[model samples]
Target: MGAVTSSMAAKFAFFPPTPPSYTLEEDEETGKLAMSGVPRRENVDVVRIKTKRATDVVAVYIKNPSASLSVLYSHGNAADLAQLYELFSQLSIHLGVNVMGEAPMLPYIVVRQVK
Candidate 1:
């Protein structure tokens, strides 16, 4: 039973999804992280929210969110903001609704010592 369990776990342990490629550069003057390669819309505001777990995540919020329902978009494990930024911007414009899209957080891995 132990061997079977270990084998099963091993299959998924290292087989995480491949995330999209993006570059984040901090401005030397403003000290703000510049998002490179992501499409930008005129009205949408890029903001960062800190989670209760002490992690910060990036989000794009359409203008005047109080007037409409917002979409809390969570990208798939294998994807990142760079790949979906354009899609989110289009959705907000075409759908005529406020859209808030968030980047995926890093997965938390737990290591156990097998005696």
Candidate 2:
């Protein structure tokens, strides 16, 4: 689809499920990052880029990547951005690069990365 309206963008930007906050709470006892009962790290930011084609939008969750580029994809093939968290974490650890994510808006710079 084409670009969304400013009104719609504002609505989703302030939606309950997705907000403009970068919060990662690490457990003092466990020394791990989590939100509620789930691990919070390197999760993909799913977007609706292909809303017209009805295909899943790609969101590459990479460690403090220097840059991000686009990739052409067919209708039914896509990777689960969230599911690759562990692997992305490993990549960051090995490469010694900070990891961040990009969805509809822009590539977010992770202020405090996961250790």
- The predictions' CA RMSDs to the true structure, in order, are 10.0, 13.3
After superposing candidate 2 on the true structure, give the runs of residues whose Cα lies further than 4 Å from its correct spot.
Answer: 1-38, 42-46, 51-54, 58-60, 65-78, 97-115
Residues 4-83, candidate 1: write the lDDT tens digits: 99999877764434543455544456544435566545676655568887876766666544436667787534446666
- Residue 104 local lDDT, model 2: 35
Which structure among the candidates has the greatest TM-score?
1
Top candidate on lDDT is 1
Q: Candidate 1, which segments miss by more than 4 Å at Cα?
A: 1-19, 27-33, 64-67, 105-115
lDDT at residue 34 of model 1 (Cα atoms): 38
lDDT of 2: 0.40
Cα lDDT tens digits, model 2, 14-57, are 44323323333444565543322224445433223455746433
What local lDDT score does residue 40 receive in model 1, on the 0 to 100 scale? Answer: 49
Please give the CA lDDT of all the candidate structures.
0.60, 0.40
